[model samples]
Target: MPKGEKVKAILFDANGMDREIAPLADVAHIPDKQIYWLIVSGQGAGKLPHPADGIDRAALRRGGVVVSDDRFCFSVPVAPNEGGHSEDAMILVVGRNWLVTCSDAPLSLTERYLEHDTGETLKGSLTAPALAVSLLLAHFDEFHTHLSAIEEKLDALDEQVFRSRQRHDPLNTLAVLRRRAARLRGLVAQHRSTIAALDRPDFGPAVCEEDRHHLTHLAGAYHRLVDTIDRTRDAVLSSYDLYATRVAQNTNRLLQRLTVITVGIGLIGALAGIFGMNFELALFKGEAPAFLMVVAGMAAIATVTLFMATRRS
Candidate 1:
């Protein structure tokens, strides 16, 4: 094991024996082909299981899968942290009777899996390949929790858009939601590729029937999640379109009102210009009544223009 690496070894056999043991220098001591799990974390990749030298140390540093004749190694992505960044540190190495896993960081799901009752008994019946799939199934459970959170956020956004009367802008909220959905989609795609590779017949030893069924069902669940996100993205885009339409209508209405007021002012200007011209007219001899009459006429013109504009609206 690597210096300062947190490594744990557990042996489980068909005889119901379950116990932790120190790193055995030889694998031939176990005659029943018993299952062994060597779980490591935080720089544990420095000491890989024997016969796994073909597994590239560099590729194992990231989240991906690589298979050779004797061993296959892969990585699983954990859920994003509070900072909204996913750290890919979980790596798995499968051999004939032993499975080794490493993560650059401590994973919550890993802790939970270790504490679960099924974890102790899984080796009794499951092969190395099936055990790996089971771990992925557990990871999918975590992924679904994240999807549920996104659904709640989408529901709130839908409510705010449709039910609220306040002039609250949802642009920022929509942008955030879209980003979250996109990130999830990318992660799901990566997982899908990894799962597909594992499902291939030539990937490694055949998994048990139960595990194969579970994997198929899990793939279906992932597809459903992707479809749900697609619908959510569409719904958010529709809300944006609705908001823009409402804004355009409001602006056009305001312009219509301003146009009416402008025409009314022009009417008054035209009348004043005609009277101010140097022309001999009997109607306006610089009398107070003539001025009052002009004022009344201007007021009447403004009122008529406003009434006509409102009626049309």
Candidate 2:
């Protein structure tokens, strides 16, 4: 252990009974062959016995940095906050009679679960698999709430996109939404794979039928969540496309206006050049009518150019 750090071990059974085993040494002397939750946080991992039969100390201590061996079926823990932002990674190692959770810091899930004192609330205590399932369900709740918020943002963005008067750029909003959707999808994929591995028969201890049923339901919920994310991504892309088309149309109109202005300015410049010449042209021969005629001709040419441009636009 890191200096004075101590690992917390909680022994529980299906009758909603819990007993705290003092210190790490008591783990080997438990009277019954029941499940215990060994929480090793901070440097507590240093105290764990290495390659102790069912427990792989090296894999557990890694804290989800590099993936553990596939044969061990360890899950890369993802802790999500109330806002659905993932906090940090941890590792879960489930065995036949013991469950080990390792992390660099204390986990919010453990704190919340402990604070609620959920032991006696249940008519019967939860099995190890059941406990794992509950933890996953908690994480998914946060994920679901986060997705709902994203969905709401998407709705607002959709309104802004469809309403032609809203001049603000939706591209930035779309880009942000796309990034969020992608990140959520990746997390969900990891979660899905972990759950799927747990559901398999050979991966871990044999879970009760009830636990299997719960896992099945959780898997279905995960699938639905992923589908929602996919749809959100598509919506963001569509909004981007609409925004691009609107920008293109605006650009075309702007170019048309600029072209008309350029033609008018070019005609004025040509007339000015002609009158500015040292050679005495008839149009500039000190006749007021001639000057007036030239001005009228320039005005007519400019008006015609503008008219044609406007008609085409």
Candidate 2 Cα errors over 4 Å, as ranges: 1-38, 46-54, 60-73, 80-88, 93-100, 112-120, 144-183, 201-205, 259-286, 289-313
Question: Where does model 1 exceed 4 Å of error?
Answer: 9-38, 49-57, 61-72, 82-84, 94-99, 112-131, 147-151, 154-169, 201-203, 270-313
In order of listing, the candidates' clash counts read: 0, 0
Lowest lDDT block of 10, candidate 1: 45-54
Task: Report the lDDT tens digits of candidate 2 across residue range 251-313.
Answer: 999898888889888988898787778887665677898888888888888888888788877
Error of 2 at 101 (Å): 3.1
For model 2, where is the 10-residue window of minimal lDDT? 64-73
Q: Against the correct fold, how does model 1 do in TM-score?
A: 0.70
